[model samples]
Target: MTTILVTGAAGFIGYHLSRRLLEDGHEVVGVDNLNTYYDPALKLQRLQRLTAYEGFDFHRFALEDGDRLQALMRERDIRVVVNLAAQAGVRYSLDNPRAYIDANVVGFLNVLEACRHHGVEHLIYASSSSVYGANTQMPFSTGHNVDHPVSLYAATKKSNELMAHTYSHLYGLPVTGLRFFTVYGPWGRPDMAYYLFTQAIAQRRPIKVFNHGQMKRDFTYIDDIVEGIARLLEHRPAPNTSPLTGSAAPYKVYNIGNNKPVELGRFIEVIEQRLDIPAIRDYQPMQPGDVPETYADVDELIRDVGFRPSTSIEEGLGRFIDWYTGYHQPISVAP
Candidate 1:
């Protein structure tokens, strides 16, 4: 079994991914600072589940601590490194831009450094669909130009791709970057739009419909995302020579998404149907640093991994609501 290190191990996606890896008999070393960016209680709960696995190990630290991170890599002899930790949220970046830089940029550099020195076989990190900011493409493709990022969060993700490429070129690091679409499911982040909408609707409160209900999202289920990641864990990228730089960097990027865009209004209606309650629609204009639509082109992901996210919103939301109701019985309004 491969010894893999997953950063942000207590996060929504990271927790799920780590559990999957452990189940697959891989020795997983999990790292997270348990930061207060969201509820630490939820993070702890996820960690508790992972701790039950015999193959799982946990470390309480942030990626910004380069010395400690390097030490951990050396100690564990980590082969595959999955960097999923980041300062998430596009709107939050407007007010706290520095947090994005510190975590996404500086922290990522430490991850790259650790992988470069630790004989890590493959370096897989999370990128976001937000990097396609201001691009009105129907289905966002990795080959499409992503140089015009509207928000600081997106800019940081783009910077990660560039930084990863630099390391791959110089050190022959096998780097794979995943640009995730709107991922939603049980044990998901409370700050995401889906979770917020579900909470509001359950409490008989108004749910804010952004872009006047004109926005569309490629809402990928969490299971599909984790499945794609599991497949790619062993499918490391090969060196592809670039004529511009004359460097054959073992680097690749793929979009892991549903490849189907659902309207914001309809998405809420599904939630309402599941909750058996009608939502008070508070239609709002598009927020700053927000786009009207996000659709993913998962052609490369399918071609390489022979997998595609096919979970429909109806079925995926049904499972999520089932878990949500059970987990949050007697749900209270969020502060």
Candidate 2:
């Protein structure tokens, strides 16, 4: 029943989250620039689906436009803001560092300001597991200090956490940041490894296996992510009362990931099984801005939200393959 705003509404996670909110009877206002970071066709298709819902409203604009964003938020009387929009992809950040700053950093600041001035009740934004850069810890936890980030993308996300904390401390904003692990599902980003591998296998092309196929990821499904966000929307963070850091700011951060980590080789095997196509493996050195593993510790997420992302790679990938084959029928393998 609340009027909620979702940035990046045409992106994979944003699209799914917006649909879920609409299905739950909430008035969902979605915003996206629909940039060519990926195929605009896919983004348009996702928006097409959302347009069917009566409760869903769409706005096409970059969040970096502070004035327009402020006007939209104030006009809509946005109660909750879910910031899922950003210049994603760690490797992409290397070639295009400015995009990360413009979208992730500058754009996020606009969102924070809008929320602060608009009297928004709750603000939930996306952080990433990549923030645990260079840390060889088994399960990355929020309690662990994430001072070191290997990529510009990770650094920006960490910066977002810092910015959100500052807003909470200064303006008494109730803010929550969810550090997402490897999120994948239907209508997922084509830039992700699984999506790329699927395309390669379908074309009988050699798929690049970085670090000689040695990597691990906690692949969380889209449903689990949307479910976590839905739960958190109702459970806003209260003022911090921890004696260790006695600042009474209403801020919290949680890792929303499947505690289970799957090896890169094993992940590819699942794709091959579902596709019935043997992958031509092209083993390569580890790319820069890449990590060997990402395992999220969801203990606090479980304790606070009473939910855990339990989607297994097998099931999640199977569902993704189903959607992929159906969506991209007569699969196009253009260079």
Give lDDT tens digits, candidate 1, residues 163-279: 999999999999999999999999999999988888888888898888889999999999999999999989999997758557689999999999999998889989989988889
lDDT of each: 0.93, 0.94
| TM-score per model over all chains | 0.97, 0.98
lDDT of 2 by residue, 131-200 (tens): 9998997889888889999999999999999999999999999999999998999999999999999988
Candidate 1 global lDDT: 0.93
Name the runs in model 2 displaced over 4 angstroms: 333-335
The candidate that achieves the highest TM-score relative to the unseen native structure: 2
Give the Å error, residue 250, model 2. 0.3
Best by lDDT: 2
